[model samples]
Target chain A: MTDNSKTLLELRNIYKSFGPKHVLQGFDLSVAPGQSVVIIGGSGTGKSVSIKCALGLLKPDSGEIYFDGEKQDSAKAVARIRERTGMLFQGGALFDSLKVWENVSFTLTQNQKMSRKDARDAAIETLKKVRLGASVADQRPAELSGGMQKRVALARAIISKPDLIFFDEPTTGLDPITADAVNDLIREQVQALGAAAVTITHDMASVRKIADDVAMLYDGKIIWRGPVDRLDDSGNEYIDQFVHGRADGPIQPSM
Target chain B: MIFNPFAAIGRASMAAFSEIGRLAIFTGRVLLACLTPPIYLREFFSQCMKVGFFSLPVVGMTAVFIGASLALNIYVGTQFGAEQIVPTISVIGITRELGPVLAALMLAGRVSAGVAAEIGAMKVTEQIDALHTLSAKPERYLYAPRVLAATLTMPILVLIADIVGLMGAWMICVAALDFSGPTFLRNVWQENIYENVSVGLIKAAVFGMIIAIMGCYQGSNSKGGAGGVGRAATLAVVGAAVLILASNYVMTSMFADT
Candidate 1:
């Protein structure tokens, strides 16, 4: 549990399951203002489920998710909470029918009720923030490469200047070089916005690049969490096994 | 590899039922979303144009041929000394039921199929997810406009079908049956156009709702990869067509004299 005052988003004793498969069991996480928390876990470790719960995409069987010191209970309150945050899904999730700028400003145009011309202008400016040229504004996501698509996704996430962001496997299928570039972009944007960030990923390199705080998940719980600099010496066996990318360690793999 | 065909079929049946349950829940949520804030008027109008105006040609063609055939059949029946009742049967058959139901079926094949494919592909590609992330309700952004448009436009399309079919019957009477065009027109207008056209429009409105709901529902609930999108498209057409015909019969019986 956090100190209650300094946290931007907080989850306590979260428990979730799908049928017989228990994906998250008593998972807890606290993200502070302007902090970059990267959650490292293997496949099916409840990372995605945890993020979905916080975003109201999935309801936890039993848990408490707080945003800005307020519980998201009523529809009005939930909408208010969502308005302050942005998300980058595992896939780019761009609207193929919409041009890149339109996709980027979708929130502003649709929710904020801005004019198309004004939203497009805002979108181009946001695109520039992610180091994309204005030319990409008119192109579709299909016209871009994988790396470019990620940048567009990033642009869309940051267009509203959200106070918090959730990145779901931000660099999952990218090449090493592109993945590294994305990691740097994530770090730069989070710092520029001075916003709290929670990223779910399995890439150790990505954690090193983007995370100020690192948390390792295993067997439906947070096995270890600490500052990124202390990751190598977390002294937790699961953390050590995962950080080293080794198959043999004190942590046993279930068949 | 112990394979039981019956077990496989049973599992498939269960999956189908599960899918239906999921769609019912989704429909409830979409209906709720429609009532919430942030009405997308522009999108709704655009979808109306797409579902209504663009679907006329196919529906028109089907209605004309069906009307001509019905007239010919009635004419043949008249030759057997049932001449006095031909107008009544033809008027009730084309305007009261066949025109709207047939037009709807044609639109379901043409419009519903396309809507499902478009929405299903959008679902798979993450456009729907993107909308959600942007704080846009996918239902309002995607479904509301489409459903509303289909509901409003269908009746108009059906009315057009009614007129075209009447024209087809006129051509049949004048050119084929050797009856004067004025007489055929007079008989159609006097005996049929009032009750039949009104009834047809009612059928068109109901059919429109069915087609749009099925199409939007299938597309919005599509799963898996390319194959999932393909299945959604197929299901939209098949489901809309069946519902259109079933609803047509139910409405006709409800409106017809005992």
Candidate 2:
């Protein structure tokens, strides 16, 4: 939990399930303005599900999602939350049908009704911000390599200058070097926008590079939440097993 | 687990009803999106080309062969009787029965399956979710255009099929069956071409909506990964085909002169 006055987004006492599998049980998380909170958890621990719930992509059977410290109880409120936030999905999730520039400026043209020429110029500038060349803008998503695609995806996520951003395993398929490069970009962008962020990733390097605070999820609850510096010494066994990447520990691998 | 036949039947029925409810809701949303302003004409036109233009060759080819064969069969069957009615009967059958149904079935295999696969892949890959985050409504941006295109294009496609089918029947009736080409044309023209063609086009529009809706429904709701997408595509084709045939029968009965 965070202070009510400063909290930007919060999922309070959330409970969710998929058929018989209870994915989130009384999970709670909050992030203050301009903070980057990385959710660290093992597979199927409902890490991504929590973020999805907050964004209203996956409805929680019972939960309250607060955006800008207000309860997102109405359809209008939920839609507004989504309209204001951006996400970088694990697979980049760029429209393969659209060119890189089109993918980046999708929200601009679709949501804001920006003219094509203006949106394209904005897309090119954003691509440049992500270190992508202007020549790369006309290419399709499939034409780009893994790293360049993530940069394009990041460009899309930041183009609208959202006040809140979600990154779902932002560096999943990239090589170590590229992954680190992406993490740096994510860090710089989040800082530059002064936005609140909630990211779910298995990559500790990503955690260290981007997170100001860290939350550990296990058994459908946030077992630990603290500043990133305290992740190793939080003295929580689940955090220990995950951070050290040890197979034999209290945190048994899911069979 | 014990096999309880009654419970199993109940569960199956409930699942079927649930699926029907979901489809109905999806159909309503798609229709609503189609009617409202801010319609994405670009996507609709692109889909028209994809659903209509790309599918023309196959539907047209099927129509020609079918028309030729239908005329041949009618000639053979009528040898002991009114062989002169072959042209009239062939034209009627093509417009009233074969043109709309065959064109629809062809599109079910092509457009329906293609939409399902593409959208299902997008679902699994989180492109749909990405769209949500970007403030784009998936129903408006994705489903509406495809549905509108199919509904608008199927009628035209079926109309073309009817003409091409009549041409095939004419060629066969004159060249092979020894009927005069002018006589064949006169026979078809004497019949109520307006009624039959209109019936077929109406049937086609309904079938088109069915095809696109089933595809969009199965695709957007697909789960898992490649397997889920494959299953969605299969379901789309199957759902569209079955609905098209069933609706064709219903419309035929309603429009029957008897």
Candidate 3:
């Protein structure tokens, strides 16, 4: 039951398949504005694919994706939708050829045609928001540690002040402290920007910290969804097994 | 047995056609991206430096040695009787064929492999997807600049290669063939200058486009991980070299009467 008026993004009956392997089948999700929804699922599930579908990075074989209550089907419409959204990739995905500042302000300089100096200043400001310093502006992504790289990526994601943001495994490969820092930064940034955020992560700690609502994706569909407070007591067996980190559950480990 | 053979042939033919169709679509997309707005001039210039300027030493070395060797072979073939004509033939040969073909082969080894590896790595690391999310078209921002740079700079590289090759031939002719230095230089300068050089340059441009397109295509489609990037690089070189040779044959035939 999604309120159409407040829903920023809606994906209905999404189906996506890669050749013989069916990845997503009848996946449905709806994200409201200013809300942070974390989609949790086991590895090899369609969590990332669902996010990609929402971002227009991957096209679903069948289904409807609506952005701001308007159907997005054409390339022009997808481009328009993407222009208003930001994404933090699992690997940070900072351009290796560019400096940190350039990577952060890439959308501003390349798309919005902002001057290099202004973009650099804006980038440094955004980096500050992510707890990074102005000194890192000139360095490359390779020069930064994993946590620092994630911070830089977060800065880049929030630099444009997008209406919507997506985080794919934001705290995948970091120490607990660093991961918590990144999670806090994400929560703060999403709240500060008042953007609709859909984070695909397996980190339950991240879900507890950043999620307003938690949706569990299984077999390419949202099997359970509710407020973050109810995530531990969702009364769904799959959600219980997943949240408690039990291997013995409805989900079988892939060989 | 008949059915099996027919099925195998059909499968092979289908695979070939599929590859060709994909390549055609990729080329069409690249052309469309080039014509569209928001061209990345900065990326284009950087690629020009990488694909053209940085390739000078290897291309130059290859051209020189090939030119010298060609001259020596021609001198021996003619029994050293037609000393004067040796410079003309060698110059024409280097300018018309060896310069562009050899330079392209070298670039196919160096530039194509490099582009494929770079783009493949970017793809694997999700930088390409990052570009898409940033509202920047990858073809315009990444592929077009490289393809355009290689296409534009190749002719210039080939022209320099032609000159250097002739100088190399001159060195051999004057020292080994006992030909006067001035006479060798004069023959090289006067022998069908525009026609020979233009043909080589044109071939170089076409070869450059092939190299870049192959590299970008293989890389942009790369999957898996480090192994995938390595495969892309290898495929880029092999595909570019084969295409370069095939295009060279067609180009030579077209310019045969000229």
TM-score of each: 0.89, 0.97, 0.98
Report the C-alpha lDDT of model 2 over B158-223, residue by residue, as the tens digit.
Answer: 999999998898888878878888878888888898998999999999999999999999999899
- For model 3, the docking class works out as high
- Give stretches of model 2 more than 4 Å off: A1-5, B1-3, B80-83
TM-score of 3: 0.98
Clashing residue pairs in all predictions, respectively, total 0, 0, 0
**Pairs with backbone N, CA or C atoms under 3 Å apart (clashes), candidate 1:** none
Model 1 lDDT on a 0 to 1 scale:
0.84
Pairs that collide, model 3: none
Q: Tell me the lDDT of model 1 at A18.
A: 94
Tens digits of per-residue lDDT, candidate 2, A123-228, equal: 9999999999999999999999999999999999999898889999999989999999999999998889888788999999999988988998998999998889
RMSD of 3: 1.7
> What ranges in model 1 sit over 4 Å off?
A1-5, A250-255, B1-37, B80-88
Against the native complex, each candidate's DockQ, computed on alpha carbons, is 0.51, 0.88, 0.92
